[model samples]
Target: MPHSLLWSLVLAVHIISIALWIGGIFYAVAILRPSLGLLDATQRTSIMLQTMSRFFKGLTHAIPTALISGWLLILHEGGFANAPWTVNAMQAFGIIMAGLFARLYFGPFQKVRRAIRPQASAFDSIRTQMLIIMALGFLAILSACLSHPFV
Candidate 1:
């Protein structure tokens, strides 16, 4: 395949993975979370765990796809030194987002998964971490759009 075509394909995958990650966070934080208050504590906890589990499973795949494709796209564009400032900013945000995810997953998320009955504080911690990750993701998207005028 032509280099340009391969770059385009990788870019498409990167964008799609970003969409899934950010879109899932948007849905969970903005929509589902608010509605979750309608349920009783036990039911709410169960539903929240199940919903987050599904989303996180997708993340296990989507995050790596985004990172790998993004690196490939960067390499195709002549490496980090040749990339625009916005691209570098996006990469920095992406790395931060990934680190936040790792912390959330190993910390509050694991606690929630293991507890016989998860506490409100545990859930709150997860929500807080997710909010930070989502904010970084949005910033990364903005940087990407700024880097590429056509976006």
Candidate 2:
């Protein structure tokens, strides 16, 4: 109803979406991957598949929400031409991160799902892509911070 409240809600949605997507990736790479290494190949692939499947499904929803909320924030601040450089950079980074995630999901992840015994490379590929995405996410956050004037 109120202008400030609407902006706050949109910002909250954007932040939560980013956290869900990037934080999940961080968990998978930093936590789950290592935990899987302790298991045998069969167990590793099985658990990795199950975990990734759920993560990907959740991200399927998060990604769009993040994008849309980001756009809303941009519009609230003013359209792209009127927005600051940092906002534009964040938009670029967000799009790139989304693209990378889509590639990982459709490419190596598909092979992993179909293989009877997926190789370590498949998992490594996924991790590498996720790391890249996470880094981009950090950059986006940094850009958002930069847009704020420092006291």
Alpha-carbon TM-score of each model against the true structure: 0.95, 0.96
**Candidate 1's C-alpha lDDT?**
0.91
lDDT of 2 by residue, 1-151 (tens): 9989989999999999999998998899999889888888889889999999999999999999999999998888878789889999999999999999889999989889999889888888888989999999999989999999989
Question: Model 1: per-residue lDDT, tens digit, 85-114?
Answer: 999999999989988888888878998999
lDDT of each: 0.91, 0.92
Where's the lowest-lDDT run of ten residues in candidate 2?
72-81
lDDT of 1 at 83: 95
Find the candidate with the highest lDDT and give its number.
Answer: 2
Cα deviation of 142 in candidate 1 (Å)? 0.9
